[model samples]
Target: MTRRLLALSILLCPLLAACSLEPLINHQVVDYFEANDIASNQVILQNILRAKDGAPLHFSELASIRGSLSNGASVSTTFPFMAPDHATTLPRKLGTVGMTITSSPSFDIDSLDTQDFTNGVMRPITPETAQFFLNEGIDYRMVLLLLVSGLRSGGRPEMLLNAPNSSRVVCYHELPALNALPTQYSILEADEPCDGQSEPEFYAFLRTINHLGRLYPLSVPQPPKPVGRPFDLDMTKALTAVASIDPGRYSLARLASGQYQLMSAAHGSYVILCRETPDGPAVAGVLTSERDESTPVPVDACSRKHGNAADQHASGDPAGAAQPMMMIGEQKNTVVFKLRSTLEVIQYVGQILALQQDETEANPQLPERCVTLEYENYKGGNMTCNFGVLFHLQRAGPAFSSPLNAVSYNGVSWSLPAPKVCRAPTRCDHTLETISVISLLLNQNKSSKDIAKTQAVQVVP
Candidate 1:
């Protein structure tokens, strides 16, 4: 009886170990990335198993990896989940433990172009290609996953997968070595800018990858803020207004996660503010640098162009240079002049003191319209700077009933709301006068060193 019991116990030990994942890990590629995070565990496992490793394997490695996780804490960093509606408490789960197995047939890779292969479905895995990965003990699933991931996300496989390039895989690899990428696989493709529309497919793809990486993915917010939206500049009586805050820093793709700081400024202008944020792998923002305008402006003189005043053409004729204002009041105040001379200049100035006066005396809801001033050189080097006042008349309320006051121009407070508007110019005209208003308010006495320090926004190393 004692011998019989001992035999039964010994038999069960092998079965239990076989049912677990501990033994096969080192023999498989998933272990390498598991040695990397929890969310990626399943993806890594699937990809490794599907790669070129030539062998039939057991199922124990999968279960063992899953069992090893301690509430989202694998061998990697701890995932701390925040609780909802509460600040001090913690959530039950900090990270996700995926139930899907990499070897599971349900996994679908849509990015691969299989129609070109011999069977018209799946490509044959040759021993030569398999040998490279097999030597590293990578499975077919992992091999295919890596290939697909690389292809979809602008990797080497993308080139070969494209037409005309499909016939030359070896030749592609023969090119020069690049930053850890084969020259064939490392071309950086440009992406089209978002056109303020919903991008469901892209959003899903990114989310899937993030989930594979074990990260909590966030969707882009609506009305995607421009990377470098300019502030309104009204310089009538006295300039007074709050500068817009920086749109957070964006992390470029291919970099690891961490805080990245950047500076924002007017394009081809000056950097007026500095902002810092943790840029993720896909966000983009402005650097505190100026773009060269030595090249001619790209807009054709024939097509009417539009944007802020800074983008205006060199032509100074008011009729040819006139651009539609963003608001009715701004349009009403705008004055255009036909150029008779060689130069044309338009300047917008406003003050906060007038706004305060108007708010106190008249209608409080309506602020003064932007001040429009234009100057043109006709003949004999003659130039005149004309000015006008704009008033909004829509307010009929009892609490506010005065005409719009002049804006305060002194730099007393940077927090005031001093909004201004200017339409960008279009077309090239040799006879058109040019608008060139130097910002007198800009600190001209500042040393070049000081200006450089402000623009670069870098710590002296």
Candidate 2:
């Protein structure tokens, strides 16, 4: 009976070791995760490049991954204490155990040519997503440029202020008498006394919208409180009042009189551009940063936090140009801009890539291009380009290349420029930061049938 019990225990050792294979294969699992992430980024870059070339856009997903793993286990029983302790029940040393886990994982990648993919990509963004980004303190300019498809307001085509003898623009034309905003993605910058050379249509529009953050501030509230009547909402009209106007986003209330009322469910939400002050009490107050037009503006990046009380004290247009009232009040304000679809964003980014490439080729050794503002009243130019700084996807020869962010397409490596700080893996690069936000938008627009990736790991014995 004693011998039988000892033999049973020895056999159990092998089974126990086999069941604990998980701890040994953790590295392999992480490898798979990283691979998928890199692939997703590459696909996005490829589409953007295609957009620049006027080629067809395509998408592919790593649908599923299956791994066939082989496990090898060896258990060798030794004497209880070598040759001298063989007779004793307690051995001087334990038996040797070892294991080797090898896996050949096969991934099933499917091209996104299906109608479902097209429909999902073409779907417009909702107000909720925009609101979420605003509340998160994302730059107002970045949000508007990426999401807004078209603006509905009265303004002159934006004008670019230029240096005295040079053609490059130094700032935006904020003089109401000199400029009004364009209603759509502009083909050219507003011709001014300065050099009239405009950037690509999209970049010009990008810079045009950059000024919108300073010229127009907004607040998105659950039960919106309008300051005045730039727009009106009612059963007869679709304009946004202090209520929900779109029936698709929120179910309109049906009155007892059997008429559809322009209203929302208790929790329904919507967007408001130039409606009210983005921060602080909605009453009388100027944003801490509002300034005079005599200062030159930094035209590159308008990345100041949109509505943070802490950041309020450190305010001025990146370009030192003058700004209009931050909040709307029965003014000729741009009420709303149509939000773009996922497909449109991809195309937008692609066009941007083309512009950047043109710039780099023109000055290969160009030490980070700086957008400037040459105000007529200001003596020196405010040279800054956070907008361009955030988007430096180095041409053919990648800048700040790493295995994590690099992609080999057509035998050339491509990657985003590195971030100045490296405190964490997330939010390390502006390129990655923008891409992740867009990716989140894509996820929000997914169809119900979209099978989100699974976290389960299967092992066949």
Candidate 3:
């Protein structure tokens, strides 16, 4: 009797488990083969599935193997391996069909919680307003379904009412399944009427919106850098006016009105380096080669012309212009946190002199300082601030290019020792903006292999 019961149990197991076959089949259908070997398996699975459960067969499988091609479509095989064949189901081109979808930049599509639709005003979900998803063109049926979903949530009634007429609606007579399934659906055509715009025009607007949204998501916000307090130093009383300037720098931030205010004070640079922290600023150490004061810079007509003009321009100004074509001295000062780690270096000796020539042309009253802050490396608990460096030229000068000195972070003020003078500081002027990019190859702790392979070479006479 026990042996007979064991045989019955074994026989009934497959029958009892057949009710939950989808999960079992799903697991069993997967084959661990190389990517190149998937085509034959796909064809085999298509046949097996069709025979087992009357599933629809995709055109590509039916065409070569079964000699059953789509009636109105042409198939073009680009590769031996797996590739999707494109097909059109339109019976006749009625003028031109067009559609589009759009969304607000502040709206989060993935997490469409109650808050997103809480406002009384329903944001348009048309192609003109869609910005969340990456794809620009969605099927007309998909557009209608999404609008229906929005309406079901009591979000936008108007959007649902005009779903058929949306600019990006794509009309299709018949739609096939994704993986050779027999499922079919129809798309709303673009000939439908909108209140003011034609179907094609509406579609073009939606297409533009979709393009903008893909390039710039609606939900993501512009990253705001940490705010650094304004610099306050008694430059007139405590600091000596005759002190030598080791490193030349500046920073700027935009106000609500879209105008950038500059901060030129040393304390501003310090605050930018140590944003929000009680500690003032990080020490920046200047890297320079040993040199005496007697070492003279090269003399050229180009450097002399603009270099002299820069000094003349700075005669009455608070901070003087950099000498033209001259290599400036280097110093190491601590940079605790200046906003972003990278600084942008512009190749504009000419633009600088032009700006000096017409200060009014480029905002006459430029701020002497600016600050930027950035958060980076956000993997759970690991985060760091990236300080940006921006440089603007005081005036246009000669086209002389050479390597500038390097700096590091020390405990005290930017420790810039052995300040190397340029050939002409006035002719080759520069100022740092709020967004500066720095080179990491010069980092002290980088690997030797990295230094040897990707390091930048310094240019010095």
lDDT of 3 by residue, 272-389 (tens): 0011113422111111111211111112221123232112111122123423221111111110110101000111112222222333334434432211111111122221111221
True lDDT of residue 259, candidate 2: 34
For model 3, the superposed segments whose C-alpha errors exceed 4 Å read 5-121, 124-461
lDDT of 2: 0.47
lDDT by residue for model 1 over 1-461, one digit each (tens)? Answer: 95565556555544454345334433344543343233222222222222213222111111122212111111212445643766676544222222222331111122211222212112222222322332443222222222121112221122122111112222222432221222222222224333232222311222222222211111111111123323333345322322233434321111012211122322332111111224323211111111211111112111223333322222321223434222110121111111110000101111112322333345434433221111111111221112222211122243333212111112221121123332321111111111011111111212332221111112211
Highest-scoring model, lDDT: 2
Question: Using TM-score as the measure, which candidate wins?
Answer: 2
Measured on C-alpha atoms, candidate 3 has an lDDT of 0.23
